[model samples]
Target: MIQLYNVYKTYNNTPALVDISFIIKKGAFVFVTGPSGAGKSTLLKLLYRWENYDRGQVLVNGTNVGKIKFNRLWKLRRKIGVVFQDYKLLQRKTILENVAFVLEIVGADKKTIRFKAWEALKNVGLSHKKDAYPMELSGGEQQRVAIARALVNNPKILLADEPTGNLDPELASEILHLFEQANNEGTTVVFATHSQIILQEGNHAVITLKQGKIVDTRVVV
Candidate 1:
């Protein structure tokens, strides 16, 4: 569950988001689409409190993300998984360790960590490459590893920003399908992308933005 009420955010003297308001219910799959500089990244950052908002409220699972104390930020982040466009994998760590690192940070037991990490890799069709370092894999493989890392903890919410931007069409479709599977398994998903190819699957909410404002919101189905 995520809610934003009359949110406003500005950078320097320029505004990035203006009067944005919307609600995403639990288990919902939502897409945020817009042109370049439309504030899609800003919106996602606000949800995770990666960037401070000058005004308005952002509530994730009923807790105000912006108002949380610095000490408790991890408590909020642990429940949400984020996939940046860059993949952000640790080049030195093997894929399995990269995914397992999340569980380790959460202090999961060794057995549980190994099992969940393996399962996450299998979910992305990359269990065979679990021992490969990030640099040893192709672009798409690295992306899959990133997805495995993001989903390894079974997060309550998933935020992806241009996750498939650098992949080929088929690879992009494969990546998007992985996100759909994650959403179907009950993790709410909010993806931000400018790609129209993602619209081919039309059974979810789509929020269009322009100049940092919510220009439109519709259920694609």
Candidate 2:
């Protein structure tokens, strides 16, 4: 459902991605793995048009993302979800409102938004935290809130960047399992991380990058 062809991205004369090419099919759970400065995060940014390519094309579900108009880009983003290590929730909003933000932007009805948000929170095991503000939650709980927010919109693809970076191993494993569950339910999952524990999980299409180029591609069997 996602394809990148001869893509390149650069910043201040230094290349971040060099002529990268790859395809991710629908419903596939993939991991973009690499050491620091290997371009894993750069590639993820390009997927959502957060970073535009300096060369070549990025196609999402048959549409050239580079050519999508700004207004249309906003609409296109609704079809994809992103989870960041920082948890990006509104500090002042309750968990329910945070997850409901996505639906609100798309003009979903109040009843529908509340229902979907609650379901997503339940999926991430954060139902009881629904009325709590972000600052009142633990790190893992905050991250779960972020995940619930991302899933509430029922996106076709979910991109997570260092999702477990700040959590303990036990919490990290829990988050990984949450991602696995999302993949099982048909949301194409792409995660970027340098965690060794994540690399050992052994159930994903792994892509490794080195110095701005893809150095390895392996399907964990």
Indicate which candidate wins on lDDT: 1
Cα lDDT tens digits, model 2, 1-221, are: 99999999999999999989999999998999999999988899888989898999999878899898877898679889999999999987899999998899999999999899999999998898899999999999999999988888889999999999999999999999999998999999999988979878747889999989999998855
Displacement of the residue 39 alpha carbon in candidate 2, Å: 1.2
115 Cα displacement, candidate 2 (Å): 1.0
Put down candidate 1 lDDT per residue, 44-106, tens digits, no spaces.
999888997889999999999989988989999999999988999987899999999999999
Give one clash count per candidate, in the order shown. 0, 0
Residue 107 local lDDT, model 2? 97
In the predicted model 2, the residue pairs found to clash are none
Residue 191 CA displacement from its true place in model 2, Å: 0.5
- For candidate 2, the per-residue lDDT at 70 reads 77
The estimated TM-scores of all candidates read 0.97, 0.97
